[model samples]
Target: MSQEITAAQRQHPTRVASKPSSYRPEVQGLRALAVLMVVTYHIWFGRVSGGVDIFLLISAFLLTLSFIRKVEAGRPLALGRYWMHLFKRLLPAVVVVLLAVLAATALFVPRSRWSDILAQTWSSLLYFQNWVLAANSVDYYATDQSVASPLQHFWSLSVQGQVFILWPLLFALAAVIARATRVRFRRIVLLVFGVVFVLSLTFSIHETYTNQAHAYFDTRTRLWEFAFGTLLALAIPYLKLPRPLRIAAGWVGLAAMLSGGFILDVQGQFPGYVALWPLVAAALVIVAGQTGSPIGADRVLTWKPLIRLGDMSYALYLWHWPILVIYLIWRGREEVGLVGGSAIIALSLVLAYLTTKFVERPLRSMAWVDAKKRRSGVVIAVCVALVAVPVAGWQQGLQVQKERAEAEAVQNNPGARVLLDGYEDQSSPESPTLPLLSSLGSEWGTLDGDCSSYDDGPTDPVLAERCVGTDSQDYEKTLLVLGDSHSQQWLGAIQPMAESNEYRVFALMLGACPFGEPNSERRPECNDFNEAALRYAHELKPDAVVAVGTAAHPTEAQDNVVAGLPEAAVDLAGFGIPVVAIRDNPRFGVNMIQCAEANGDRGDDCAFPLSDKLSDSSEMAAIFDSLQGLALVDMTDLICPDGWCSPVVGNVFVYLDDNHLTKSFTASMSGEFDRRFHDAVHW
Candidate 1:
């Protein structure tokens, strides 16, 4: 987190920045620059910098040196005590920032996100936010801006924390191997790190390609950077390059590190082979050491302002992201202008300094904290307690909100059958806010059984295995619903219709995969699942087949499409079963649940325009035109009426997340849906 210490820093053992006696002010300066780059990319560019990679290398590099010194000198590893020392040094600033985020959430962020913020707060405090984010990445439904968990940046810290604890154990093992084999301890350590570097690099390259979103936060995928740092540390003593070459290497390394935001596509190319550029540059700079040449980049790194910034880099990094998040929420916008961004940075630096001065320094300097295990335990307990307060409050609040929502859903929400007798004038709660506006996330209809949602099965909609009968006791006829979650949402509404019509509701649904050609699929598994759903639809030989008729994209005026469709609908019609394709609902990247909370009384202010929001279902409506038994249930008018789509309708939130309707909203729509549906099939 900090730069290498000059003799001056060693005197201040409680200093926030980590210090090794082999002081390199330039490296500290590099740390400052790296943090600045990260902050810049986050605010102005929405890009990632090689700066984090640089920090990752430096942390491991410093730790490796400290461990090697202890091993060679035959000093006690004091593993537990050293670990306590790191915890004391690293945790205070984190706890302070997390508390600040909680405060901001209470003030600025919507209650709709309280659960997520609370969860992420706990994850960040416990140092495992990365895994949480990785799991959310594969969940197609988790995609949206409102779900931007404040503690997301802690993923790097989580990775660093894992390595901090693990790397020492590695050195301990290396010491044992050296003692037993009569080998040089340094050589044993080098061998261990070399194996790690190779294994992790291989995994990183493969996983990055296979699942980049999850891989981005995977600690295993990032291990090579740390291992490479260890290797660099082991090699530094033996690197006997001349002064001129070392100076040249230092400049080249600095430039490469700076090039990350400009030259690299951080998302697509990072934590893989592309990471070698910044990581190797870091190694070069470390090996380069402080050059004697006046022109060396080292001179710039050691500048007083840069060194001071490095001294507070850890705090700066923690505070910047959350501050930016709060600012965005306050402004109710995604990106900020230059002035607003500058204001954010200025405020971040001030807050970072305060955190370093009051929180980190006070706890780290406590005489008992690092000196006694009992006090370290107490300090750790206190930090946990500090975090628990807000997390517990938020969870309790969410539970209360859920309870209130259920109560409201029962009382205020009119049954569609009775309401359809008159013009649609669904009643709204006197003041429907987050608790009611976003109540539907939990209220959304869900179905998952062997036939409805299974890991292994033939998913062809006609097959009995892929199909589940929702109400088999009333099964006078069959109502088969097929396709992805969009189609699945309809189950709540259609279940009633199916029951009333003396039909059993059967659904064969995949998460994001639609019934389409394998080539048009988003993932290979999706393609396979699509084939299964298609086949099951054919096998079930149902009286009716329900599916979403459109595919979507993010581009403006460009969402409508049958780009993902190929042979499913026309071929299904050949079975003489009516294919009821519901027009795909418009999608939004904004978190309407949160948006409604921020906009106050007229939640309609958050409404999305039809031009930008709508996705095309007309493609299938036309393609299925001449195919008998293939009915296009154009419900476009229902989803986005008159070129505008609002999140709330009749006081009920439509989307549970971004695209799919909530179970309650869909359930209420049964009357209208049943009417259109019957008319479409001419039943």
Candidate 2:
């Protein structure tokens, strides 16, 4: 029987091959180093350390090796069982951190932030936080503030979790293909992943160049990083190097990895070709393996302390971000100093150790839980429910409050009406603002109508999609609204007036791109959008064209009309389309709503002098007089009454963030806006 077994093993060398040990102490140490770099850079430097990329590569490398080994051994893939088991181990710490974040948000985060936090909590729990962030990054109205979400760091883990589910299937498919074609499984995997690497890397480079913010979290753009790891795993076993070269490579890789964050702009130019810097460094370290020399990087990486920390690296990564964010909020600091950062790191380490010891390890080692796939699935469901139930309840409660607030606003919030001549302030002082602090997230202006009736829209897809008709199809005349987000917000004012006056209002607008002649300083896309909007306007001549003619500054003494506004107005006048230029509203350096909430909404300390927000004299006067078809309407007196602009005007929140007008406030300005429109256009 022994002789027969030996002969069978000889016939299938892979089945009984003496493979290199799957455990690598140096890799564990590398994990420890990578996570430390991430925490340190985030807390002190406010930069990305490129450590998450290393984690991604290592995860795929280990996963590919394990799956390939199982395939070679002729074992069942059991992908479903693997997924259940893997998430069962991963989710306990994640749940603990999420629940902690929920509690911290309630205690430290402001009411204005609760809605966003609630949404992110669900996204993080479901492992789709990366997609949520990518969508937000590209949202035209998304705030450009520097406030960081406590759950933002989960983007990488979300990406990793998604890949974990898909990568095993890839290996399984390769195994099937190999059997069908009578080829080696490793060669098939190499070919399949090679194509994935090439295609995904090319897409990543192009997308990163085109839209870096969205590309940063896009899974398609990140697949090549995982593919590169799988390819490295397939090639590592066959690679042979001299001892001295191995030693040199190990040291060089370690040095490069340590210096990568300082030398490269990882946050702005990552997941692209530039990402190869840290990836190649990590690959070199993996290639070095166990170079049996004292001076080799493996010697330092094999230290017992680092290996121990690596055991808790996942928990550490999860705990540190929330702690850092909460600390920043609690202290009102943008970045932490050495002492504060040290305390944050220390607290994170303690929490991570506790979580790993009491939560992760015990559940991972539970005998009954490991015995059945059903048991693991039950644990995952339970973990999800633990976070989801309370989050849903909180959201439902907030919805009730928002509805109540909206009803109250309809009854008592007069908004800009109070600034009108002979108006009375009848609202109770106890009544909350039009958009309650809890409901501030929904303050952005939106059209109550669509663009379907307009048959001759702009040919530019972006402009055509944005062209909205906010009135009944049976209209006497058409009014074209054009410019940037400032113009979009004014739709709140235009909609009511159009409905009453029997005018069809079509809004053609883009965020951050005011309608004008293209300039070298502006983004090429925005410039192109401007030119397209102009051409479209000339062709489809409306009765009148409304746009923001001026740009406001936060601190400058004089606000000026945007460059080329006069020229664009003159050009449009030639097409018989009268131009109504609405002077832009005041912009503040700080969040005016947040300030109001913080100061009891009395609008005392939050008020700004009109002198600082607007020019001493009208900058549009000269152009308004010179151009025959151009009419200037300045509502600065209404928005900033008594030469002072307040956060809350007649029980209504005026601005959503620092600049854009709240829809409620603009809606209340309908009467004043109509009077001004008629005075200017005589329509």
**What C-alpha lDDT do the candidate models reach, one value each?**
0.74, 0.86
Best by lDDT: 2
lDDT per residue for candidate 2 within 1-683, as digits (tens), equals: 22323443466787558666789998998899999999999989988999999999999999988987676655678999899989999999999999999999999987888888888998898889999899888778875446889998889999999999889988878877776776667788999999999999999999999999999999889999999899999989777889899899888989999899999999899899988988889888989989989899999999999999999999999999999998887777788889999999999999999999999999989989989999999999999999999999999998897787777765578888987789877877777777866676666666667776557656568687777777476888788888889988888888898898898887887778887778887889888888888888888888998898789898886677777777888888898888898988999998888778778677489998888877864455775667666788888887888998898888888888888888889889998899998999886
Off by over 4 Å in 2: 1-16, 617-623
Tens digit per residue, CA lDDT, model 1, 46-114? 889888999999898888878876654446788898887788778878888888888888888766666
lDDT of 2: 0.86
Off by over 4 Å in 1: 1-22, 415-419, 422-445, 448-480, 494-512, 518-526, 536-544, 551-566, 573-578, 586-595, 598-625, 634-645, 656-659, 671-683
lDDT assessment of candidate 1: 0.74
**Candidate 1, position 474, lDDT:** 39
Q: Which ten residues in a row have the lowest lDDT in candidate 1?
A: 1-10
- The clash count of every prediction, one per candidate, is 19, 0
